[model samples]
Target: MTDNSVVYDDNIMITMRGVSDSVGLPYTVNPLELVDREALVELREGPAGSAGPDGDPAWPWQWRGDVADFSALRALNLTTADARAAWRVATENKIYYWTGLEFIAFDQAFGRTGKPGPANVLSGTAVTGVSGSAASARITGTSPGQNLELTLPRGVSGDVGDPGGPGRIQDAADVLIDDDHSLAQDYILAWDATRGKFVPAPSPRRGGPWAIAKNQFSGGTNLNEPKVLAAITIPGQPTRWRPQVTGQVRVNAANGNGYGTRCDVEVRIGGPTGELVGYGFGYDIQNWDWVLIGPRFDFPPTPTTDFGVVQPNQTITLYVIAKRVKGSASFTVDTTGAQLIVYAEPIR
Candidate 1:
């Protein structure tokens, strides 16, 4: 009898062939079972020794092979489709795949169902209780089979809105500041947020306060105060001033001897005695005529508060002096005790 109890490739029935014909044995058949004594011996002791690897040392079934041709032994397909499907399901359920393969969550394969629907279905996350420029947050959930959403809150601020278009310049006065008749042409102004006020126009370049008058001969605008050129007083240095004119200085009689004489000042910054640094000049009024003032010589020590990071002790002093040609009259040339105010402000 052929070994009918053995499991072979499911398609190959080991006993389908006549055992007697195949094994050169006389086959005997009974109603209950077919038996061939010689064939049974052959099956038990053939080149393919036994049914299982554990039972037989020379078993043909002891080794594994490509299952593609196993159809001859089995009726069912043995594809790993089920395992792959389970992995995808695990990715969808976020039970295993998310914790394992992070890329799976971002990929369309994991969450994509072959369907025509909205990409995402989350409602607006409204921030209910917000006070100032501090803290604010909201929560929202998406629709079924929708992509994840990430929302963040912004903190409070001291100001509001997109900050409307810059303020309009009403007139020439808004554009000008501390302007004397002597032409100070170029100037700029802007709104100061910290100080909550409008700052006067700044100089286009490093120089005197930019001023200009239409007519120089007639002297139309009578500028009362002395226009400050540049002033730096390092405590240890000499304070000097220079007159605008180099040669003979004269006061127009309309300036009333010295009353109408206005002296221009040139300030030279340097070390004490006569070490040159930087220089600037502006008109200082005597009576009213524009008279030359000094690009002076003066040296003053650097103060701790003024120059940051720059070592104050290492810095040399600034020297300042006032030099002006004598007036046709005594007082016209005299600027001994003239008042000067220099205001320096920073622009961001």
Candidate 2:
């Protein structure tokens, strides 16, 4: 068999054929396809005017080009005579070759009218394909590969919000430290569990002179004990010393002897250089003639003679030393003590 290829509408087709040599044996030959010159030219021009067989006009005697108006075409009064006349004149004199019978039928099937079909009438067909029928399904039984799966194009995914700027940890730490204070307003130092050292707490809520009203005291017990509950460093202006005293130390005698025991309160004000700024001693003991007896609170008989003062460069410390002695038939001595209530500004 010989393979022959031909062009059909706007494409090519291949067919097998067998030819015999002089020996009458069949041999295969591949022949080049030939173009139908007449058909090609006629199809290019589309339908032509035709005359009727009986010398009358054909039903659609005059054919229009692609741009002709369809509505106007229907109004044309073409008849059989027009078609016959056109066919006889053209065929006999060979003025133009005739389109095959099938081609003629194709042109007049709608009787001198044409209209736009579908936008996709040529859908699924590849132009310039092997055959006029268009590139059809694979005929050689070639298997199709796996189906292609489409996905979002690169960088075309969902919108992602921009990342927030990193937090400023160092700045935040500085802010926290700024708000913290070294010691309490009236508290000099406090126990810190984490650092295992005395941490300065903020100043106490109270301030100024902290007083003590003594009520009772045993022989040598509890008198020398300080009533100054707390001392704190002042913030902002840091030049003055501040200490606070609280609670009371009662001075009542424990023994009921001839005369109760006597105790005196003294305040000493000085500086680290031993410069005395003020001094005060209150005579709380009685019986000064024989060896003071009885429990008493003597203010030096006058404020001018007993008041304690603190100079700008001095600090104050107070001591309350109480001693009692008996010179009668029995020998007895009692000692009790009390501390002073010292008030001052904060010293940093």
What TM-scores do the predictions have?
0.18, 0.19
lDDT of 1 by residue, 1-348 (tens): 787776444443224322334465554552233343212222222244447545555312221222332222233332433222212222233311222222222235345566776665544444424344444444445454333333444455556668667665534443423343122244446565665545554443332232222221112123343232223442211112121212112222224434423343343334333433333332334343433432332444232223211121232223233333333322323332333322222222
lDDT of 1: 0.33
Q: Residue 332 deviation, candidate 2, in Å? A: 9.1
Each model's lDDT comes to 0.33, 0.33
Off by over 4 Å in 1: 1-231, 234-266, 270-318, 322-348
What is the per-residue lDDT of model 2 for residues 1-348, given as tens digits with 9 covering 90 to 100?
765664345643434343334454333434544454322111122234687567666343433333233333334454544442222122222121123221132333333557864443221222233323323332222224222222322333477899989985324333222235433334445455675555555453333454332232223333333222212222232234433332223233333333534432222233222222222222233322122212122233232333222323343443333322322122122322322343553432
- lDDT of model 2, residue 326: 23
lDDT of 2 at 134: 29
Error of 2 at 51 (Å): 57
